[model samples]
Target: MTGARAMLPLGAALALGLWLWAVRDLPWPGWPLDPQAMTLDQIRMGYGMMPRGVVALLAGAALGLAGAILQVVLRNPVADPTTLGISAGAQLALVLATVAAPDLLGPGRWPIAMAGG
Candidate 1:
């Protein structure tokens, strides 16, 4: 376990290297090491792809964790956010908030979201 813990950073580095390598030839020019030299399209692609990777990982993790917690707490094998009506309630609240008070999305918006939830 200690040996595996020591390799965790290296493993993360390897994963990052592989991810960058996979996108190295995304119809873009030169590397993005020096942002000043990167074209607007290349910069855009880099930023866009970073979020695609980060947000997806985060959202997936959150949902999976939430589902697991809900199942455990409810003592059921399949109690997800949707099953508890949280998913729908939040969406409905967000839609209503968007229509009634679009400003709620600007800052300190989470309380409103929780209300929706």
Candidate 2:
């Protein structure tokens, strides 16, 4: 792989580790529906829930990789999750889920939601 390509995973790992470390000590805000309110400690301490910080970091990295792939495939600098309608599709899916099936927003829902996108 090219240097930039080779560094991608390493960078993602570092970023993810940093993110998990940053939130590992924060208290969960007791908002079940809000991802931001969730914390690494809460995930470890209660219900065996996965860490929101890791989830967020992974999601960010995934999106970045997806965008890079799209841009390269399309030969367009502007190609991205937005240009591919992925962002809109994800938003629509979340809106529908929130309105029609709020239960899907619970723990372990992120991967499902992302898959839906």
Candidate 3:
């Protein structure tokens, strides 16, 4: 198999293994019919750790996709947010909004970031 194709499963396995290791301390919240029956550890695992893990995984996937798209569009293998100044622009915008118009940030930060990027 090609190197990239071969590495896909390896990367996924490594991520999964790492996630499992990170959450090893948390007790598994098995299929509980009643929420009241769940213990503190189970509730923390189910409500806190699980959603955060899912969000982290999704965000990582999205960043990878964005990087791939940027590289392809720019015709440069090393193209990234920094290369295009997107991240800097976004941060600058946020800082400016915070200093100039704090109200704008109170509503939502995503709009300002998108506008700047």
Candidate 4:
């Protein structure tokens, strides 16, 4: 367990290093941050790709945490949101909210989805 815990940070660091290396060639925004100095590629990379990557990383982490919590709470190693219908319930709630009250779909969506799940 200790070895596994020790390896976690190392693995995360390796993954982050690889991600950085993969995007190293993309034109990045320069320091002293002048928006006018940024080229189109820099703008695309900084605004589009960087944010998308960060969001994906965070979403993956959140899903992993949720899965871990579900497994622990259910005492089932294979428990997942899909298997428990949690995802389906959340999706249904979101869809219903979208059709019923589109205005509630913005800031209050999380609570609505959690209620359904």
On lDDT, the candidate that comes out on top is: 3
Write candidate 2's Cα lDDT for 1-115 as tens digits: 4998899799879977986786576565564665456665665645354455457668988987987788899999888777678778778888888899888888765655586
Higher-ranked by TM-score: 1 or 3: 3
Tens-place lDDT digits, model 3, residues 33-88: 56698887787777887899789979989999989999999899988999889999
lDDT of each: 0.81, 0.73, 0.87, 0.86
Clashes of 1: 0
Clashing pairs in 2: none
What's the alpha carbon RMSD for model 4? 3.5
Selected candidate, larger lDDT, 1 vs 4: 4
Which consecutive 10 residues in model 3 have the weakest lDDT in total? 26-35
TM-score for all predictions?
Answer: 0.54, 0.41, 0.81, 0.67
Model 4 misplacement above 4 A: 1-18, 29-32, 92-109
TM-score of 2: 0.41
Q: How many backbone clashes does every candidate have?
A: 0, 0, 0, 0
lDDT of 4 by residue, 19-75 (tens): 888878875635336668887787777778879988998999998998899999999
Error of 3 at 2 (Å): 3.4
Error of 4 at 25 (Å): 2.1
Model 1 per-residue lDDT tens digits across residues 1-117: 699789979988998899888877675655668889888778877778767888998997898787878888899887777788987888888889899989888876677768877
lDDT (Cα) of model 3? 0.87
Candidate 1: lDDT of 36?
A: 93
**Would you give me the overall lDDT of model 2?**
0.73
